[model samples]
Target chain A: MIAPLVIFDLLLALTIVALAVAVLCLRDLFAMIVVFIIFGLVSALAWVRLSAPDVALAEAAIGTGVTGALLLKTLHHLRYVTGRLGQNAARGLTAMAPVPVAVLLANAAFCGLITLGLAVAFLGAPAAGPGFEGLVAQAMPQSGVEHSVTAVLLNFRAYDTLMEVVVLLAAVIAVWQIERGLSEAPAPVMGVVWQGFARLALPVIVVVGTYLLWVGAEAPGGAFQGGAMLAAVGLLLLLTRAYVPQPGHRGLARGAFVLGTAAFCAGGPSGGQRGPRGL
Target chain B: MLEGFGAILIAMGAVFFVAGTVGLLRFPDIFCRLHALTKADGLGLALIALGVALLAGTAGAAFRVALVWFFVAIASATCSHLIARYARHGAGGVP
Candidate 1:
């Protein structure tokens, strides 16, 4: 019953704790980035266990997906810099840090925080939100969606969703403008197999994205979910340089980004007053 | 029964992650270590996420967990590709 689920959750939490340790302890920058991606996935799982689907979706999409891409790109650029600057300096710096002492301090701090947090959560629970609960429960029965979290998000707190869209739009705009001055694009030097695999995978991702969007109204998926899927396609193309921006492509990308931002700005505040008819 | 299976998968995933970490630390070279991190780590995470998704009572919860798996797959593969590209360009080594 709930006992086993509790154990599963505990195990997941422990695994994540260990994974985070692994992420921090790895010395190689590439290995470190890989560990980070794993940590993001595990944490998203933890969010799911805690009953927050929207948060999980956001964590997976932005946290792992976009953020990981950014890190990987940065790592590549940094490695180039490090390589040209000479590995001797990097190795010397790494050797200077007393590894054992660092680990000991980090472990002590981590364990202390976890123990304190668990103790607080275990004893004397916080007060429940009566009004929010009423709103969630009331809106749950009437909303077309079956999932309570979905109803709460799409109905009760749609404003948040709107705001997220706005933020995302803003981010894309900022990145687009920053890259506008660059005359040359970075080309991906992947082998032929990667090219073929990406070609094969693109259609599948497109289908999955469409399916997620269509099912989102009733299930856990949605436009954000679908867009992430589409973004993955774009990301893959970007990675492979297959979809690298030509003159026309750059303009289209900028326009599409602006459209998304405008949509988000208009849609977000509109939904705030829709649910309970209150400020 | 489902939950039991999930527990097993989760354990297996953790083991794979540990193995990947060890491989990354001990391997003689970057390419081999990347192999361990990419294949084993991706499979490990997908398994663990799948297990959690199976245990979810509601569709929304399951979808969310599954989304994490998908993201991990996307992020890890993409990042690994970039890392490999960087390394092949002679970014790091004793030389």
Candidate 2:
């Protein structure tokens, strides 16, 4: 409503529109990837604006950070392969007359349907079941946890969080196996600077991660948050080739990856089902 | 008073996000595009998270949102690394 804020919002909106247009118009595949990374960041910002910090965080980490990296790598590989072997190339020939128009029409129809469905869903906000607000309030008053969501995630829905951890571990294992199947050993890049920094940073990161996990019972943190931090360390290690991920190297990575799930699963049945805590 | 600031922060974040996207689209080369995305996403999310944290009266709510913020950062960074590696190794780009 203020003039400056309104101006800011308009600018943001314009930028998003411009980027989308540019991404669609760009001829180069690499340019498209770059556009997508920008899109991820913009979306994260949008999430924050919408009063969802958690979503924003996830968007930043998973969307822009991880997904952008993945896309860029893929594009780079494609470019390299194309340059060397010239294997994959888009054909310049159109099979039939008016094919472009027909293709456009089909895409338009698909977009229309998706847009309509999303709009309709967003417009509807039916009354939910027994509200968690009441429960959360009660729990807060009695429980030791300072964070409501942390309480919900760890105490109420501990089992779900646990399983989620397992899923992450499974995914990491799959990635490792895929690379291993290709006969790629953990090619550890050697450098005193890289190794030294990693050695220093790893311990600090680990300590922070552990603090997050341990404080979850009564703080604004938990396993999911902690696990992600821990995973980041592995990711960093992998990046510099500090800790080479070999074919069977499944000790710390494996444990950290699955710790949340293991904890959750172990808590369930043994602690008796109290409420809903599914991931 | 705080509510007004929250609104301002949120709006500013959105602008950055859009700016990042535009940069990404306009930038030539994979690395340059990545730069746009990382900068935009990190700032945007932080602003949004800050707003949310302010709105959250309880510590738990704030924590939950913060957790999301933390995870998003980790995930995004990791993905970027993967993409870079794929390009370098699979495509034979410089490591």
Model 2 stretches with alpha carbons more than 4 Å out: A1-3, A13-29, A73-114, A126-135, A142-144, A159-163, A169-200, A211-221, A250-260, A267-279, B1-95
Instruction: Give lDDT tens digits, candidate 1, residues A1-279.
Output: 578988998899999999988987877766777788988888999988887776787678767876687788665554443353246434422433456988989999999999999999868576663646666777676776766655665556676776665566566666666655542534546565467668868887889777765576676766665677677777776777775557766676556665655654565322211110000
Best by lDDT: 1
Q: Write the per-residue lDDT of candidate 2 for residues B58-79, one digit (tens) a residue.
A: 8988887897787667657655
lDDT for B11 (candidate 1): 93
Over the true interface, candidate 1 deviates by an RMSD, in Å, of 6.6
Query: Which candidate ranks first by TM-score, i.e. highest?
Result: 1
Query: Candidate 1, residues B1-95: lDDT per residue as tens digits?
Result: 98999899999999999999999998999899999899889989988998888788789989878866775587578668756877876432222
Clashes of each: 1, 27
Candidate 1 residue runs with Cα over 4 Å from true position: A1-7, A21-27, A81-133, A141-144, A183-186, A264-279, B1-95
Candidate 2 C-alpha lDDT tens digits along A1-279: 578966766777787788889877776666677897898788777766666665665576556655666666455444443343243432212222355888999999999999999988767745565757887988785555677766676567765766655666566667766654432333433334445556756776678667666665664445544555565676666656655656465565455445545555676412211111111
DockQ for each numbered candidate? 0.11, 0.09
